[model samples]
Target: MAQPFSVDAVVWDMDGTLVDSEPLHERVFYATCRRHGVDLSDLDAGVFVGVHQYDVWNAVAHRFPPTVSREAWLADLDAEYVADQGSLTAMPDAQRIVSTLHAAGMKQACATNSAGVVVAANLMTLDILPFLQATVTLDDVKEGKPAPEPYARACTLLGVAPERAVAIEDSITGLMAARAAGLHTIGFASNHHIAAKPEFHVLADRVIHRLDEVLSLVTMPAAAR
Candidate 1:
């Protein structure tokens, strides 16, 4: 059974949650690392999941020669990813869920660990800019996910309290951020993060494979009124 729907706002994670761009992102990461002569294994790729691109670059740079410039490497990686955004896709039922929520008068916002440019590109790609009431990026916060600042900032922007917001996330880091912000969370397991096990117990207050399941949680029950 699903939990009852009672939240006033929905806070979304843009990357893997709203768009099917994680795999493409991984490809770009591998390509960029190779171009810089860095060998990244699958596990190394996994470690970067849900982290901001600049942070990932800085971390990766630590494994390279001391003289290597992290800023230059990050710029190159950003260039590659920006050029590759054309291949991105909206996740299953993303548009449907978002549209339904918007029509229902529920507040909606995007809280992502991604850069502002990346978030803008994705919103443009998915044609969902008009539906989103607020957008928060890593640049807007002193700290990113797992720190709670992103989600907290998002709720503030949306004019909603943390307890009144529901967060939809696809990675453990994202789940932790939302949880830390005191919001109810739903975990989507379609991507690499939760593919191995139904780790709902670890990341989310609730878990569902399909986006439509969110409707049950966000919609008011007849008995409640």
Candidate 2:
């Protein structure tokens, strides 16, 4: 079947879509929470996968009985993630798809809820930073995923309309933002949370297993090329 419209660009979610940093993030969040006397063991850290880093911290902070301020926890978490940059790993086909899309002349941007520090570190780790036209994070907008602002900011930076772009994400929150921006959406089931959450899949037009499959699903418009 012909695509409804040629995909002129792609906006991707960072953590699970392009890079498998969920485990690393989870570990760090859990560790940070532990230090603050907040036990996240009972709560699924998976729920925070695509949420804004500050929001996550605030929520955890509210639940914890820690005497330390949330700002202190944020500082400590940032320090740890910077020191443990070794934890980031590219998802399957992340390189192949990104490189191919760049070569095809598709504009690309990453819309992530992670902080700039983590986003920069992961992009550098995956070696896809140079391939992207823009990167939008919590710091870039007043609202994060589940809010259309981040994706809207990304589309604006990429100089593309949301309807002409495809958004690939791993979490419902990310998909919600993409959909709210009127972008076509694909769910990358690389995160374990994808299985536990059926409603997330319902938000996507299609769910893909490997990043390379994105190449099969989209083609940059001739004008962009």
Candidate 3:
């Protein structure tokens, strides 16, 4: 059995952890690349999973130069995501987990590397914004995932110390950010598109296959954590 731990606040990663948006992101990315006549046949699409769009674009541009400017490429991707907001559904039990924690009087927030525009579209489209007390996006931080600023910003916004908070994430970058920020980390590995790997298990305090498992982690009381 998993040991109980005190959890006063829950910070979530917006992409794969809360919303099933990676597939959409990947699709749009490839479509945009193709439009720019950039051939990514040899590139691993999985590399684009958890990082910021600009970082992804920068890496792509460095390897296979795109015809469009960074701003234009980003705008195109963002517009595509926003227009396809209907496909931005929540991960299984993600809504229940958020609502359950909220009902239990726990503070909650979303910390993401995504831009505010995309984050707003995803959360608002999925009706998750109301349940989140705060959201820290790349726009709100000088540095994003793998830098700890996003999660740190979120903890600050929630007025909760990082040690007392739990962060759920689905990507290596997100996990690194949460752990580096001093929050207990849970790796959500149920998404087959980004299945849990060795590094994920190593980084997370615990790994859960479903979002519903977060309920127990938050509700249970521990003698010591």
Global Cα RMSD, each model = 2.6, 1.8, 2.7
Off by over 4 Å in 2: 1-5
TM-score winner between candidates 1 and 2 = 2
Off by over 4 Å in 3: 63-67, 220-225
| Location of the lowest summed lDDT over 10 successive residues in candidate 3 | 216-225
Candidates 2 and 3 compared by lDDT, better number = 2
Cα-based TM-score, every candidate:
0.91, 0.93, 0.92
**Distance from true location, Cα of 77 in model 1, Å:** 1.6
- Among all windows of ten consecutive residues in candidate 1, which has the lowest summed lDDT? 192-201
* Per-residue lDDT of model 1, residues 134-197, tens digit only: 9998879999987899999999999889998899988888888999999999887767445455
lDDT of 3: 0.83
Taking all chains together, the TM-score of candidate 2 against the true structure is 0.93
Q: What is the lDDT, from 0 to 100, of the residue 127 in candidate 2?
A: 92
Sort order, TM-score high to low: 2, 3, 1
| Tens digits of lDDT, candidate 2, 51-169 | 87777876766786657877788877877887888877888878888988898788899999988888889888889888899999888899998999999999999998889888999
Off by over 4 Å in 1: 42-44, 192-200, 220-225
| Residue 149 miss distance in model 3 (angstroms) | 0.2
Residue 225 Cα positional deviation in candidate 3, in Å, after optimal superposition: 18
